[model samples]
Target: MNTETTNTERSTQIMHTEKQIEFDKIKNIWKNLAITDYAKECIQNTEICLDEVELRNRLRDTTNSKEMIEKLGTPPFQNITEIRDIMAIGQKGDCLTPYQLERVERVLVVVERLRDYLSRGKQFYNSLAYYDENLDALPELREEINMKIRNDGVDDRATDRLFDIRSKMISVEESMKQKAEQTIRNNKECMADTYYTLRNGRVCVPVKKDYRYKIQGSVIDKSSTGSTYFVEPAGVAKQYEELALLKIEEENEVYNILYTLTAMVIYAIPVMEENMRMIEKLDFIFSKGKLSVDLDCVEPQINLERKIELTKARHPLMDKSISVPLDFKIGETERGIVITGPNTGGKTVAIKTVMLNAYMAQCGLHVSCKAANISMNSNYLCDIGDGQNISENLSTYSAHIKNVLEILKEVNKDSFVIMDELGSGTDPAEGMGIATAILEELRKSNANFLVTTHYPEVKEYADKTEGIINARMTFDKETLKPTYRMVIGEAGESCAFYIADRLGMPKEMLENAVTAAYGKGAISNYKFKNDNLKKKEVKNVIIKKRKYHKDTKLSTLYTIGDSVMVFPDKKIGIVCEPVNEKGVLRVQVADKKIYINHKRVKLLVKSEELYPEDYDFSIVFDSVENRKIKHDLDRKYTDEVYHYDIEK
Candidate 1:
């Protein structure tokens, strides 16, 4: 998939569907197994196996083995990638630690046991028949490491000399303890306490501070109060040094053994990696099978027809007992679906259900439905939420548009798209127009898409469009509630006023709203006249003429060259002529002349009030160049000014 579609799927929350919930549940189950990080990655990136044979094989394996695997209990597997890395290094002749070698032994032992267990059923179970027993279990290597390294990570009796050294060290330590005890008894009077202790890995006697000279030993540690001395007697100091040297030799011997064992395992790295991979694949398969059992899901029929038919489908995350089962189909009969309904009527949920199930089926996981027939698509994209980005200065509409634009570029016959509340968050007329155009483009592209909207025009377009069909969420007018049932081939009503009346809104207001929405006859069925009917009817009447105060009359207040502000448009302009009999005035705004309704224009400054009584009116209505030309002409012919003024 392209990054744009991938990002759209994630950002739209289309991937965060019921299947994701199922995926999470399966992940939680695998957590108990403590699988390797490599195995976890394999599981996480598991995609829809488009190959029919491979997909069916996986489903069959899971279905056949889920019970047997559950009875056998979860396999005990530890993440061994680190151990594998150490083995890789050891292959280069580098020494490994005792604990690292022990881990290698443990992993081999587990793999060997798991392999045997799986191979045992190869003849008895079809699921186990896929197990390849020919893969090397590395049994000899495991035994060799086991013999060299103890479970506690200490070197066992692998070398005769190392064993002899440890034995001699233990004997020497016992003798040193006895010597210290005898010394403590001989110096009982000088000792602070009648006990011997080991300090700094050497046997010591706690001697009184004042009698310290009597001990004939070197002080290793002093008591906090300086009342006693922890002394390593000069007599057993040589034995302590010998034991320390023996430990160093033992460590070197253990390292040599570990390095040898690590190298042996490293020789079998290819087989070991293969074995780990097989086990991980098995774990992932069994996990999906276990999830299927838990969710009561069934393997769906996969096809290349670019269609889906779901019967009694429920969102996987919902409570099956109460979740409304939906019968949704697309791609076969119609390439696009336009879902229309009022708010809280399950339109969004229905679209989400289709998207989630399609995704799950494509991912090779059984969907939570009675039966499903799904087709694979190359890309799945959705625009389902208010994708507002404040950092980019994008509003909800802009964000939706941006997503749609990306979708338009990527959509094809093999793509599946789900969009929620298309053409929302803007003016209804233009929003509907943009939504229709998008739908037309999607149809032309031949991609499968599902969209929800409240616009009636969109619903009409869906009805008339060839490849699109209309569906709605059923609403109960009597109960004033949504039934949450999706009914295809129908258009849903908003029922706003009816629901409002049922919610105890004022009846007269609801009646007026209904009449306004539908027609005067919409509420004619009501037997009683509304108490506020006369008042509303009076308010609706249009007056042909308005009585204004003499001072506010437009004809008397406005004159030529007056500055005024026009209503509605709120533009300021200078009046070029007096108000006509029809209450119209000619106004000059900049270089443009416009006719204004006299009543809608408010007089700001009368020409007589702003200028001298004899000021020329041409300057106010003409450009600066024209006024200058007129001024120069008048200077040349002052007598002709009277003639020009008369002609004007």
Candidate 2:
């Protein structure tokens, strides 16, 4: 029951599978639910567990987290990026800043709160409590960090020398300020601006430049023009020197305190790392539980018997209000399902739903379903959309055939494969032939598979083959629309004639299409009424041709493709569609085609005189982009067209 893959090979396959099923969209949802970037990374890097024990443990943890969240509120694991960055710096033998030490204490406090929160329900939520034990709050270090650092600075209580030095600084600073004020009062006449100011952390008095040496110990500062000078008296100078020495002592003591705190943080780094990992694991588990709740998902039964039964399963990525729920099964008497339906039906979605649920279940996530029973698979292989690679020079058919060949090589009973519109993008007869052959091979391999196709021949093969079931997305014949509801054990008709008739195609054309498809009306033509179209109908009538009024009508004056200038507007245009007998000529002006009386327009150039005998006028009439796209399709096959919905 162990299916764990190893190293780069497994990683490549996991990413490939994710791309095929668009698992990143679901992964995005899971990542956003997490509180911390660490938990988001855990979701981004995790792969599906194929081993029974590993898979079950993941599911069990998620289940326990969900129950714990509902009963005991969410665990408080706040996002703490600073904790990791500071720890890294501490590891490099660098002393942490006071701010970083404070952040460390904050994280530790949260860890302690989370630990106590989970421990309360240990007897009932033991699985959740396991992670709680891994969270080492380190209360002793937490208390130490908080006590030493307060408000992003070393507190006085941090060290006795720091306290004593700071007290001395305050007293020296007061005494220096008093001495500065007294000197300013005595030298009022010699002062330049009459103020005592601090320069380089020393008290100085502004003095007139002419009286610089009158009362001074040292010049501390001067004005830009040399009109004024600053001096500190010798009496205050000695006391100022003592104050500076005490300030240096205070700085040294603060550095010592910070060094000791940094060492303590470094010592606790290992335990903090363990605590972070535990928090991330818990965050990741809670995110899964939150997704289950947000999507209203259910945890399904898992077994190793290769049997999958889903009742009312939904595609998690789709809008539940509009999308139809799928009811499907496989890996039992029938290991393969061949889905046949009209284009744009829910065939591809239904197949993807089955594969996505199995993939999620293997990842230990809940399935978006009312209820289900699923099995572990060694691999989830799929080729759901067009795999065309222009750089690789692979056509749609070539890409599909290559993917099928690779799938054939890897599939076994323990594998689950979903193929959408297989054997498409090629000749219908050849595609159906290959589709049937691949289905037969899959049946023989005993691998559970779901494939959708529009080929009737493949449907017939599924109908007659043993251990293969035929399903179809239901169609409404009256409305000519697909119901998008899958019905098992039924072969669906293409209903091409019904759809054509509904779209206003002539009855004769529908009959011709029916004859060509079913061999001369092998099946009855669908019944449709012209009256049900609910529009006005004209009855057949005959009339004589209009009599010529020679004087009343304007004579034809321009040939088709001749450029003409219309009167009044002075706009030039190209003449198109020949001038009618009544002298009304069709002309193209820019992108619009207009009809004007020939008398109001005069030909500027003759069709024969402009260029050659048979020039293509559409070059001027058609857009440049359209001409370019047409040229591309003419040279080689391509799906890109200027306006596909209009032209085709």
Candidate 3:
């Protein structure tokens, strides 16, 4: 029997990654838990002389049945007697002693002889009673013999011979098994029902309840009542007395056996520890299972429900209690989101939500999503929040610039990038100008990027430029707390005066500050500029890029004229289009249509058109090989290149 299949796989299959960690934590807390499992395995593996449940009963045998219930919680079996009759002695509330067991053994010898004689006669007696046509008792043979001899009133030789045989049987009867006879050599009839012996060649018989008569003998004893007798034959009487003590000795041996068995309970301590550890792990897994986020809306659906999916993703440090569930998918034509919101509005969490979920999915735990449908870039670049290095005496704006510079060096056309607080910690004019410039460079670089910023200038860039969009986190002035919700196509309203007034600032001072900054016209100009930027919206380049991508794919598919898969990142397609060159189908794809690979493509045919052995559908990806290439400047950048060739 493969215990491994049921016991090992079942125990491990219930655990997720987090649950495994939880189990480790529990082991640290209680080391003995591992031992508990080992103990259980030991019991299970022990030789089963009895049935499993019966063996369990024997192992738990005890004199005090009440203590059994208290300690083990439940008896391993219903009644210990079901496994053996010894349990009955315990039920009588009198513990068996060794002396009693020895006595029983001696008594059983006599019982055994009687049982053997009856066994031999049983078949014949049963046949006479059941097999005959007329079942009747045997005729009176003794009376017939006596009557025959008496009726003749003569000296009958045959009658005389029978009487002689009967008288000799009492004096000369013997057993062939001398050893068995010797064990019961001291023959005593203490009573018609009970027997007792003494050293004085005396035996007592109890003829009436609680009344006894003694018999004394020279080599043999006769009762005073003459109803029962005894025999004393030297050492035989002492041997017989020892036989009577056998039952008690055996009972004591049984108690010793059980005492040794109970010592094995020490092994159970570890088993309980291990069980407790596993229990705690189970608790943690179930606790995570209890999270009820709005993941249903993000369930992966085929083409019609196509969207970016970030399942059960969260800010790694935020406790589960304060965590907010954020879900959004860009509709068709809504790429390049611009998140604009007040401070502490969960902007950072939202950004991390996207990044960490992608990382987690790559590592292969089923994402926290009800369903996940995602289109991913082959590469990713992140320019998240960075604080200025005081040791270098660098300002925040300088640090931000250095981070963006590093980001620009690595980003490619097929990369996804996230930038937090895109322009900040510098002169307002300079920061806004640099922010718009960076967006322009990113747009031309052909990378999908997300940027968060407070600058109105950055928002204006989104409205005026193609392949860009604006978004904002919602705020409630009445509550003065961020709702942590995003609304697309809107810029965050900076309500400085309103907040100052709510915070118990003098109303007159707030009014004066607002008038000094705005003069009513500055505020009007702000709205006008925003409205103008919306009017100046240009054709989004991402829409054009998607259209071109769709066209390229359609063209390649058309050329092949048969079903195939496209690796868009590498701009390659494996065609079933047969050609004379090497007599193999040519893989044709475009370099500009980046990321399509031969590994991504497959030969498709109707099931009825192929046999099981006809085709191998497994696709193998090529290992990247470094190739040094010459540039116009005679300098070379070592490029890791990959190419595919059909094996069959």
Stretches of candidate 3 exceeding 4 Å from the true structure: 1-317, 368-372, 390-394, 506-512, 515-519, 522-648
Q: Compared with the true structure, what per-residue lDDT tens digits does model 1 show for residues 1-648?
A: 999997776544433432323444544544444366765676655555667777767667666556555556554456677876876777777777667777777777777777666666565565663575744668788788777777657564888977998998999899888888899888788888888897877789999889989877789998999898999888778788888988999878877776677678778888888877776667666666667667777778888899889999887777788789999888777999898888998887788788777776776677778999988887677787887889999999999999899889878998888889989888665788899999999999999999999888898999999989999999887786788899888877676766775666566666655553444566775433224333333233211222358666556656787767665455778888777778788888766778866756665556766668888878666666566667878678543332222112
* CA lDDT, every model vs. true structure: 0.74, 0.80, 0.43
Best-fitting candidate, measured by TM-score?
2
Model 1 stretches astray by more than 4 angstroms: 1-34, 43-75, 120-124, 132-136, 155-160, 208-235, 241-245, 505-512, 520-648
Worst 10 residues of 3 by lDDT: 75-84
TM-scores of the candidates are: 0.73, 0.77, 0.35
- Backbone clashes in candidate 1 total 0
**Largest lDDT belongs to which candidate?**
2
Instruction: Give the clash total for candidate 3.
Output: 40
lDDT measured at residue 517 in model 2 versus the true structure, 0 to 100: 47
Model 3 TM-score, all chains together? 0.35
Cα lDDT of model 2 by residue, 185-230, tens digit: 9888888876789887778888899888888679988989999888
